[model samples]
Target: MMSRIPTDAIRACVEHTGWTEQEVRNVLGNVIAETPDALLEALPEVIAWAKRIEDSAALVSIMKELPRGVLEITWNGTEPAIRIRPSCDVRQVPEGWEIVLPDEKRHAST
Candidate 1:
């Protein structure tokens, strides 16, 4: 069965990639910086197996991205599917994860 995706999954992915968050952040920033208009929305429900399964290697086995938004991830863990919405209430943020709300339209950057 698939596992649920947790905010901590970000760190797991970091560990699996053997890359620091700053590095990944920089890479992603560079890739998306030029295309700020790009909306790379992820279902996350697909790659959520990492939450229940502790083995990163095995986790990678069932991790597969079917499309830009859909993922087909599975592992020897319990990753129950769930509904994700942009307008949903925010869950508690995990360690090392920060929830940044979009800037107010009326407020200018300091």
Candidate 2:
């Protein structure tokens, strides 16, 4: 089952970051544009999975994409299906083998 970015999640972000709803909407608008509803729905799970893999940088980067740098989701041709682009230091998470990465490429995964 697919999950979506909840209104409360966005509200929480706005409250924590002190950003206006419009600002949040602008970023979310771009996000929706790129991947559409399904991926956005999967955002929370994707983030949790990223945390499980210790890819905090990626999570932060995804959140910081005001003008750009937004997490770009794509099909990996696998069951994990969704792939996040602009992933810096790619590391594979065993569950569904999702590729998670930090913001910068410090070391290459072998």
Candidate 3:
């Protein structure tokens, strides 16, 4: 069965990322739909990462692809770069960035 994402989490994402409630719900809902077990475990991390980037579009793009693969953030450059990669293909995550959604967890790379 699919799990419902917590409303509080949605609200937090909206507040932190400057995205509308609907936008937060849409991205999170899609992710939860794809991975029922990841709801609670992934929500906090999602919000934290969202707060690090000022680009709502980029964050949305990252969240949308999370369920399909792994999310990789690289902060070594002048600006953070986010991307998605197949779970099986993830390498050692670099410094200043974390990899999300690998194996049991899922989400991006570049």
Backbone clashes in each candidate structure, one number apiece? 4, 2, 14
Model 3's lDDT to the true fold?
0.61
Ranking by lDDT: 3, 2, 1
Ranking by TM-score: 3, 2, 1
What lDDT tens digits, residue by residue, belong to model 1 across residues 65-108? 21122232334466544333243233467674333333441133
**Model 2 per-residue lDDT tens digits across residues 76-105:** 675233334565434557663344455343
Root mean square deviation (Cα) for candidate 1:
20.9
By TM-score, the best candidate is: 3
Q: Cα deviation in Å at residue 87, candidate 1?
A: 61
The segments of candidate 3 whose C-alpha lies over 4 angstroms from its true place after superposition are: 1-3, 32-37, 48-110
lDDT of model 1 at residue 12? 60
Worst 10 residues of 3 by lDDT: 101-110
Rate residue 70 of model 1 by lDDT.
23
Error of 3 at 64 (Å): 25
Distance (Å) between predicted and true CA of 11, model 2?
0.6
RMSD to native for every prediction?
Answer: 20.9, 14.9, 16.2
